[model samples]
Target chain A: MQLTGGQMVCESLIREGVEVIFGIPGGAILPLYQTLPEYPKLRHILTRHEQGASHAADGYARATGRPGVAFATSGPGATNLVTGITTAFMDSVPMVIVTGQVGRSAIGSDAFQETDITGITLPITKHNYLVMTAEEIPAVINEAFHIASTGRPGPVLVDIPKDVFEEMGEFEYPEKMDLPGYKPTVHGHPNQIRKAAKLIEESERPVILAGHGVIISKAYDELMELAEKAQIPVVTTFLGIGSFPDDHFLSVGMPGMHGAAYASLAIDQADLLIALGMRFDDRITGDTSKFAVNSKKIHIDIDPSEIGKNIPVDVPIVGDLKLVLKVLNERVKPTTRVDWVQHVEDLKRDHPLMHERDTDELLPQHIIQQLSELTDGRAIIVTGVGQHQMWAAQHYTFKEQCSLISSGGAGTMGFEVPAAMGAQVGRPDKVVWSIAGDGGFQMTMSELATLAENKIPVKFAIMNNGFLGMVRQWQQIFYEKSYVATGYSRNPDFVKLADAFGIYGARVTEKSQVKSAILKAMEHDGPALIDFVVEQEENVYPMIPSATSVASMIEEPKPEEIRQ
Target chain B: MTTTESPKHTITALVEDKPGVLNRVSSMFRRRGYNIASLAVGHSEIANLSRMTFVVEGDESTVEQVTKNLHKLVDVIKVSDVSIQNCVSRELALVRVRANVQTRSEIMQIVDIFRANIVDVAPDSLMIEVTGDEDKVDSLQNLLRSFGVLEVMRTGTIAMDRGLGDEQTDKDNSSSTHRMESGL
Candidate 1:
């Protein structure tokens, strides 16, 4: 069919099953916006900034397990997507980012609003393309989606010039992609699975370390079967919070810096470590040399590079976790780990994760737990990076798959607001809570207007501590109480700001008002914000200092001894 | 396996002949902190495929990482580690050395002994071309150093395994010939 490049792009997106896109219009990409009216199936959310657009797309992908689509103009618009692209890259989210370039004639000429975005994003994207002709639009878009969504998914950029978007072309979408170098391992070697089964049956103490791959592969059932059959406890990584049920009998919880102490202790004591789809990131493994010292690890993952990248393993099986576990569950025999489970349960009982607030002051943990409790631990929670994020991870109980979404590897500060909008848009039937500290919430608070315009039903809760809480905690511990520039003495009234943006708003200062405020926000038909005035100096405890061993974890002080 | 001795590896890769693939290759190497001793690229027998040969210094795991990382690039089709394998390889060097009045005859005689050819001759210098493995080229350069070598250019190592109907082979003799030639 004869079509313009813009029509081809819109057609290709629909062909790829993309129903929504989050981005802003710019001069270079006007052709796409002009063509948008003809295709009513494609819903475009006009984000305030390009960064928010990319992150919202990221949140959409995380929630739905489908590749998210985003659009932007050239130059600054393209550059703004860098942080979001890197965030997706670090977390391995699948997204296809389309950026408009200056006319082909002015590509290297440094024309107005021109940027070599593909060159800038070389190392960050899984693959990128600079389309010169309109004839290749359908094929390029098809290839971009295929590459972005398959085999350890990541963002792929397709930079189209304004001329290409306006040029005439014959659209033909390819049904299959032929990429020899991109073939990923999908199934494990049977011999290796047998070996893993042997180890599982022989080991007295076994611990399962689950990561985001389990969630991405949707292997929760297979994982539960294997863990239950072998009687091994599961410890999830930071981003792997919702991959396993937090309330399960064998779940030991998250381990590492700011993670539960018993989980880290369990890792240190295990004789066999069955690692699934996690890279053993530095934050998770405090000191690589001493991490799980007594455990002989068997690492199973789809990405072969991740197997031995950080920590060496005894059995490295490269395959999809769900398929690998399905085969593994057949050969594995049921075992009884009565004493080891009891010992770990005792450790969990001794070092139970809880909130400590001496006075009647409102704590962020109290708010997070309330949100979790009120929703029956089923609401999808999105968070930005900071003390509030850690509180959400430690305090909230995740019972459903993909229940917690946060900027984990990147630790991006301004992620909550737009990401929550994306998550809500992706799964409109489910309830989503946007939780952020005052420091992080202000970074992209402009997206509140986007939320109001779209009527995206996300309940936003601002943990107003009046400080960059995480940085302040570090300063208090290592900098001898020198606060430096971390403290914010004055702030805007968030409730009033939410009201200005045409959303329901409330403020909570007393402890008694916390539950009611959350309930009110949940009961609101549309987007709502609750400004929570929390203790300013509370630190996330059970901390493992950077590069320190699990033995050196600093426990939290007693509630009365901390502060009034 | 000695701690003091650094290990070196030879890798050859097949990549699509397109723009920026080389940059992607080098960028990955640079970002990963892999040290390259020599690299050479040219069109292969295939129509649109280019072959690249790189000689790099790394340990056992580092070499494994280099091969695996190169494979991750979408443009790269095939990669082989021929560092210690039974492969026939060659290096070419053109040395421009001081050769005035009487020393020119001695230089020509030494070149004859090494079977090297004089590619060019200026009034004050002789440009001698030598082709062999890395050790052979280094030996000729060392012999000419006493005559005050003016300049030299060496095409890094390019290799092919013996008895090659296939581009890759699974045979191994486990010889340590690389240890003898992989030195600086």
Candidate 2:
């Protein structure tokens, strides 16, 4: 039963019920790979790049609600995971990153391939540890899992020295972690809860600003009940896309700098603001002093420090959103504020979320809508950040939180396809869609091989605008429409590219053929890419530019008043 | 005035041995818009295992809920209202006071009055070490400060039951008994 540290790590991972580990090998982690083959149940996925592996792990974490494990060796291998780790950290995704450290004696001396990964990742991870012995490896892994998945869940790292993995020790996993100084309080003061409930009951124009915490805490049903009881309008953060169904009467879409005008206006006029599972990031709350000035705010989040960090909270509730929302729903009286609801509806009708409709051309919004309708809100929709992603957010009516996953924090361009493949593996029964622009798709197009190899049948809808659409839009607005390096001349034929991977592919240039093309892609059963040649000059409008007050967004330009 | 009784209260805490646990604990109450008149924590029967004692100055119902929530954390092992239980509390402080020729004899007399020990004697300073409850430490520190106290270091207050029974002892004895019975 005695095993080396390398063997012990694989054994511990096996014990944790980890079926697959995504990693890239190098000199520092040779010992780990040497022992990995012995564990038949644990599969090791050899990623082409450490970034892909980290993102794949992140995808798995987002899909499964469990910490996805990824490993890499020191130096370049570890550095490659930095962008992915930061992506996971910024979005509060739970992950366990095990990096192969240089030998203990060589550390700090800057020996070959040695890097201070723990020091480098200090600010990004929830907590990290350097294992000195094989015996400590199991405990550190256990602690990493505990910290990564617990309150305000975030990524944790364990840097394992090469020598420690080669050493021998008793391999016993600790049942409980003894982190004395790291207790997080997860319940609200009853008096404060009561006070918050009373304020909700009293306010006429109340709104619920739901964020990613709602999804993380699985509080959608409770949030719905609270909204119904208070009859308050609900707007969401980009990450909280599907928290409340877009079809719901009270569901105004996301409210922020790039959010729907009606949602932003509602937030601007609210008398009582109940912010749940939201950090009130700068994107959401512009000029914090001016945001929600007329409202008495009740801020509820899992982390205590975030309660008043950005905006002051009249009543701060610290606990899991599900529990807090359930309790709040129970205490709050059922009352309908019809007048306030109608006022929001008025805004919605006055300046609707508009997309330029081109009858003969395949548009991004049209493609996204057909995709949403085809999936019937059951698919996992991931997006590469750009006009395509925003179009999906604006048009697709997602039914649940986490249903629409994207890199909201880092907004990494190449994350959609591989992340979608990772998500599909987690949700095998459901369809997974990766909606990326022509510019974003090319960033991680190599992941097409991953899909083909793994037999993960993801639907990739590439809005082929033949340019970096968002950047192009900015250039059009800010700079004279000179079109610098934004446009692409000889774009690769996406159908031929998908065919190169030995999968189904199609190109839809006409609007009439868009639905049939998507349906055909969905029917293929293997990985399929539908490159819809959308209008190159199309821009995502109703966009409240950064730092611009949400109240005064330039709604769609009049039909004839268009400058072009 | 509403003729209703308020809830009970208990101060439950988990503390580290870093500097200023007392000031941090007490000041937390002040900062969070609460008031704490009494507080305590010290090394348990187990080394580096510290026990905290603090009274929750609040309504009874609110105090009960707070204690329950606090005990839910892994760091917080036990929660008991020392106010209800007969307990002993103690604090240790080292006071370094100026000991010039004129003040040395007077300071020595004052130290003796408080049953303090001169742990260190520099050319012009005597370090007087004292241990007791909060009031005793405060009174002693006041007396020494008048003698031109140079510096002060106090171990935060720690408390335990006056009787033989304690959480640390109970767990230790149970484990030992189990080991003997199992013969492992």
Tens-digit lDDT track for model 1 on B76-155?
A: 99998876565666788999999998899999998987789999999999999998777688888999999999999998
Q: Report the C-alpha lDDT of model 2 over A418-506, residue by residue, as the tens digit.
A: 67877877778878899988887887788788778878899999999899988988888779787899999989999999999888899
Clashing pairs in 2: B7-B59, B7-B60, B7-B61, B8-B59, B8-B60, B8-B61, B40-B53, B41-B157
Interface RMSD of each: 1.0, 8.4
Q: Which stretches of candidate 1 lie over 4 Å from their true place?
A: A355-358, B1-6, B164-184
lDDT (Cα, tens digit) per residue for candidate 1, span A1-564: 999999999999999999999998898999988999999999999999999999999999999999988899999999999999999988989999999999999989989999999999998999999999999999889988988888888999999999999999888888877676678788999999999999998899999999999998899999999888889999999899999999999999999999999999999999999999889998889889989999999999988888788898899999989999999999999988999999999999899776445568788888888888999999999999988999888989999998999999999999999889999999999999999889889999999999999999899999999999999999999998899999888899998999999999999999999988899899999999999999889889789999988989988877766763
User: For every model in order, what is the number of clashing pairs?
Assistant: 0, 8
Predicted structure with the largest TM-score when compared to the true one = 1
Question: Which candidate wins on lDDT?
Answer: 1
TM-score of chain A of each: 0.99, 0.96
Instruction: Please list all clashing residue pairs in model 1, or write none if there are none.
Output: none
lDDT of 2: 0.79
Candidate 1, after superposition: displacement of residue A5 in Å? Answer: 1.2
Backbone clash total for model 1 is 0
